[model samples]
Target: MENKNLIQKSIDTVRVLAADAVQKANSGHPGTPMSLAPLGHVLWSQVMHYNPENPDWANRDRFVLSCGHACMLQYSFLHLTGYKITLDDIKNFRQLHSITPGHPEYGMTPGIEVTTGPLGQGFANGVGMGIAQQYMAARYNKKDYSIFDYKIYTICSDGDLMEGVTAEAASLAGHLGLGNLIYFYDSNQITIEGGTDLAFDEDVSKRFESYGWHVQNLPDINDLDALSEAIKNAQQETGKPSLIKVRSHIGYGSPNKENTAEAHGSPLGKDEIRLVKEKFGFDPDKDFDISSEVSNFYLEAGRKSAENEQKWNELYENYKRAYPELATEYENIISGKFSEEWKEKLPVFDDEKPVATRKASGKVLNAIAEYLPQLVGGSADLSPSTNTVLEAFESFSPKNRDGRNFHFGIREHAMGAVLNGMVLSKYLIPYGATFLIFSDYMRPPLRLASIMKIRQIMVFTHDSIGLGEDGTTHQPVEQLIGLRSVPNMTVIRPADANETAHAWHVAIEHTDGPVALALTRQELPVIDQKKFASAENLEKGAYILSDSEGQPDVILMASGSEVQLILKAQEELKKNNISARVVSMPSWNLFDQQNDEYKEKVFPKAIRTRLAVEAGSTIGWMKYTTDGGDVIGIDRFGESAPADELFKEFGFTVENVVKKATALVSGNK
Candidate 1:
């Protein structure tokens, strides 16, 4: 607090850089970065544990800009603090191919923890980081050598809080008692519509407190001492997550637009910028300029982080000597490596007895859980429904940090974000589960998961109208198609218990992106062994389950609960003296990767009469359904009725499927 002028100058430097970038780009949010300058200064300089020179340092504390539109704040800080983001990159904000885009994307930008821009996602991603922290600490840290004691700090805005996803994640963070997670709420009281009071007047601090968070309020926006003290107090509270509400103006330095809505998005004119600089006692003409001394302040901060990392390295050496096996496991977890035996342990299902994919998923989870000790996750109050909870595994709770099962209450949005945080930790295979229909509530974070390409599992059960009396609200009609549309996402809808088991196996094997396994709530009859498709074929995306006796009439393709209908259709076609082939296409993305030879062999390049059957949308089935072929799919939303009634009414039946297949084969007149 002694070098108050220098500290204030450094903070003001961030504000100017933000304003300059927004003004130069002619588009971008200047309000947040300008207003929250002091808060960012305190967190980055005095609080965060990170090395700007080594942004990928494993044990460093993570800082997520959840309100990513305020990315100028982060880009400016990274440049001044010695990261790879150059001032030129700041000048090129919102331009094509630039690291600084409209939103903070992972892999594209250095020091960005998660690809955040869809409001509320960064906060949820922070929750995931907190989960990883606890799991790693419980598994790796020794009595004296606590190597992974790092916090995940998030800076969010009113829009972030207004979004429902953050509310769900905040509740889960509290439930887990993640003391290492700290959030700095930019209480700027303004929204695009003018003031937050016009739309959002609920007590945010009280809401977080209700979730058992340690809440603090800083009265003065520019008071670094007060902000620092509140942060320290929050850090000291051990059993709860923390939220520090820092009151700030939308544009803190600008003389006229400081607290106005105009500062929220539009850049202040050059004249106004000059006036703001004069107020801060800065040269009115200079742009993106900071004194070397002010920049060096953060360099010293970076050097301290490197020294801290070196100290941790020495302690870890001692830890390895004390617990060799555990240390090895810890290293593998951090490096994103699973045991070789984990691959071998994947269950193989067959068309033998009746089995629901959800039930099979439960069995597969237990088997894989046996081999991978670091696999941790739970359901969004749908453990029984999703069949994601493994038996004999400890539940992850405030009292039991070593447990694996996480009860995310009924908050689906939070579950997805928290899992992202856990995956971001790079030490645990985190998964979340819920009914497939509820995916709508979780899509924002789920989209971020695909963008981040983190290895997280989404065990979505109650797929389609097959979920029974749970009704239309619970049924997932468009969810499958919605998930499939996302690039880099693998959407797997298993037909039976065996396929469900195989889907889980493939999901874990996928290290590049997120996997959504849609399981059935109703029990499905396992296919006959000879008639069943190879689980290995799932990796190929699509394969022939029952082929035509010759280069014959029609090809029937389906997935998930509807694959059974395809089989029934095939049987009826055989009875009618027609030879039809059946294909179980569990994952289109995986199948699309197969060689053309394999694809042609299954669908036959010459056979043009095709019929695609699935309980969901037929939008993307045109590739398989040739010019004359038909698609037997639900084209509209489902109704609130018994699962059986919905399925019949919606035409998801063997009768309709067979009729369509027969017509396609005959080139229906």
Candidate 2:
């Protein structure tokens, strides 16, 4: 067994590096890294199964620092353990272009698993990573070779524990029985303002216990053996996640700022630095010191990691020989390749069999899920209503990781953050669903996913006033526009079932960033093939569903349920001896991606009389509607009545849309 004295020395090594780095940079949170040093050392050196040499190894353990303010502690460990992080990187901490930043970002740093700093995001993400591991192990792991057997470990603080998202994720983790998920709570009893008692005084261990987690308390922060034993106990508990509350003083050994909020952030002054260095038995005059013995100790961990990788490779070779087809799929998933057969499997919609885009979306998801086994997701208590659940797949429960469905309950915010973590794991295609109105609750994670360019899916249903009876609270009036505003985020509001299927088709194939599918609740009439074009044109953003004889005087543009309204208006215009064109604009972002020539061809400038209508906010319609164009849309919150009444009260009738179109045509004439 590693001696307690040796572990304490290692922890001191981590603490001193953090203190020196913060002191040198004249910035950063010193208290967390200083206090959590012993716990981090215990977990990384003794319990965690990560390979510092190959941070991208598929089956290696995942580590997330939920308390991202304490990034220096992670950087110090990475530097000492011989990961890509260097002492120089730590010196340049929080610099403009340096790898070491204020927070731990997934792709930016070598060992960071998820981009964290947003309070409970890292903890929520850890829950997601645990879920991904369970699904991967269930789907691919053979009896002899434990290919996907890995744990997700995270170190969080009072801020992370206090966030509502953390509570939601913890509940879900317990319900799923993610035994491999272990979290180390740094119980320093200090926050930025002062003690946690100021704003957060809840008993964290009891709260986690309520969430069905096995809670353990380590009275001594310096007790490495006890910490390891607690982890062992957690690993042995096959039906519950574990939370270890480590009681420790913030900035332990620091003479002046120990246990004070002053140590939470900001660099210790040069004088205080000298005192800490003297206490750690380091040269007060020198900075960034790593004893030769300490450096050599970490090199052993690197060598052991390489050897473990080699063993896994040999096992995989034998497994490949035994199961060739499964091996090919595994390699493809790891390599981020999808068979063309998967695309061929995507359902094609005919205009004659008009279906609600949400229904089509569900079909597309089911088809893609059949080929891409890594695809795993759930709705925020709206699985059946959102049409996001896979029919044949089982629910992800405490006892079984093989289940495909995720029951997120009512926690939209946590579900979103958890999805981000799963995507960061690189083993599962994570997605979340809820009513479009509830998107406001989950916007933070959604924005973070966009900023990180993570390929996660968000299914938003009950898109507009068409949701009915649920009132303005349930119906989303501005959400579509709000979601569409996010850079690199593809928002698809499918018109009919075929378009919805195509939207999912594009969503799954897109590997760059996040994709959100906005779906409707009501059934839509299927456009006749003889009268309307195929739904494949939906990829163009705006496609002419029905056209006039020649150079139409007016054009009608709409999306989702409103597309049928424009079509009805077009028929009425034709009967009145007026030439009108109907366009279905399913996704404005995808359409903007289309070539300029294609855009102009779809919306001819010659037809200056354009009318756009939808049952949502009008803020986004200015782009489609030109100077002479008119938009018939809801400008304010909807009413608490039936969807049909709301639509009528909101003036979402074909007559109103036709009136706008007729006025534009008359002006053109």
Candidate 3:
């Protein structure tokens, strides 16, 4: 039997290390870490199937601290458990260039599952991981060889549960019956405010129960035995996800701050730390002290985890020998390598017919889905409108985890977070769809995805004011600019059906960061590749669709549906004996990555008179438009009218474009 005193000492070591890290940084939240340390110890040492030496083990249990303000707890565990994280790294917490940041970032730290600071994002991310685990197990696991049975464990706080995204994710998780998922709600009764009762007074356990989750309420956070038993029970209850409502005190051992709001965010002062350390039987005078016994215990745990991975490796070898093709596919997926033939599967659009870019996107998705089995996603209850449904696949539900299509209901916020979670699996490429205007609802996760640099594709249809009749509330006037403002987020607005197909190609290949595809609901005439530049140039981000003879007098550039208007205006300009070049500028982020020479080649410095037309805000056009240039864009909300009528009323006609281009060309602005 394990010595109870040693376990207690190890738990205390975790707590003291977390507190000391915060004390050293003089920033960050300490209370939740102090309270949740026992739980962390129990999971990492006894329960979790993680090899610290190989943090990327495919079958390892995922631990997401949804309340990322308490990142010290994770860092403490990483350091003690013989991960790459060192005591020096913990000492350098929140400092520049340190592995330990203010919050846990996925790739920046060895053991962090996802980057999370915003409340409820990590909670939903865990749900996505659970879904991925379920789907993968169903797809590859034979009856005798259960390859993918890892559980996703998340420790969330009152703040995380209070966020609306968490509610949406919880509802979906319960509905899907993700039994591989287990979340520990740290019911500390305290927020940054005085108490959770100040703003949150609902019965959390009852709420989760209503969502069809297996709810277990434990009144003590320090009860390792109870926590372990609850986890085992959760693992056994394979019909539903589990929520263990752990009633923990904020700053568990602090002499004066326990259970108080003061302990929630700021570090406990040195005097308080000394008292807490003394209370916990540690050297009050020392900082960041870890006992040899606790270190050896965690190291042994890591060794056992490595042994578990070795066994899995052996099984993988056997399975590979038995099932060569499936094993090869699994290896390729985990390594983020796709067959070269998948690129050939990208659809080629017909120029004879007009099609909505969203429709084109749907077609492209299906065409490549056969070759790229890693691609899986759904729309946010707007599949019919967004055209994101995969007609060939069954919906991902409780009954069939092997299905590729996911029905995200109307929860765009949770969908975003869940997509991030799925992508974290390193084998799944997840996308979520909604109207471009509703991107505001999922902005937190979108930003987080970019920050984490995860491979997530967000399909946004009804991209602009052109999504008419729905009026201003549904129209996205500034959404494009808002998306562009996010660093590492590639926002692609295709000009036509063919460009839409190529845009998907770029998104699939561009795995360094997140990509947002803004597609139109209105049908646009497909640009004939024979007459203009080939649609393959879409990879360059901005390309000359149709160029004038020699030095052009004016450059007419636009993106999305407005590119057609620019093309029409080019003909009108030529009728008046003026040379105008039409450029399709799809993605500013991708274009910016191009060298100055390429950018200059597309928009020559000599072409001073330039006009940009788009159906959204004119904020970002100045970068391309020179001194004598101007932008034709809608700055105000759209009216409830037919899309054609609204375009004409808002000066988005060929006549308006011609007039604007004429003025710029003639220096008559």
Q: What is the lDDT of residue 480 in candidate 1?
A: 88
- Could you give the candidate ranking by TM-score, starting with the highest? 3, 1, 2
The residue pairs found clashing in candidate 1 are: 128-421, 128-422, 129-421, 351-527, 354-526, 394-404, 541-591
Q: Which parts of model 2 are misplaced by more than 4 Å?
A: 1-9, 351-354, 574-578, 603-609, 665-669
In model 2, state the lDDT of residue 301: 61
lDDT of 1: 0.84
Better of 2 and 3 by TM-score: 3
Q: 266 in model 2: Cα distance from truth in Å?
A: 2.2
TM-score of each: 0.96, 0.94, 0.98
What candidate 1 gets wrong by more than 4 Å, as runs, is 1-3, 350-352, 531-533, 639-649
lDDT of 3: 0.91
Question: What would the TM-score be for candidate 1 when compared with the true structure?
Answer: 0.96
The C-alpha lDDT values of all candidates are 0.84, 0.84, 0.91
- In model 3, which regions exceed 4 Å deviation? none
User: In candidate 2, what are the lDDT values of residues 101-212, reduced to their tens digit?
Assistant: 9988767888878888989988998998888887877777888978878888888888888888998899888887788888989889988889889988888889999989
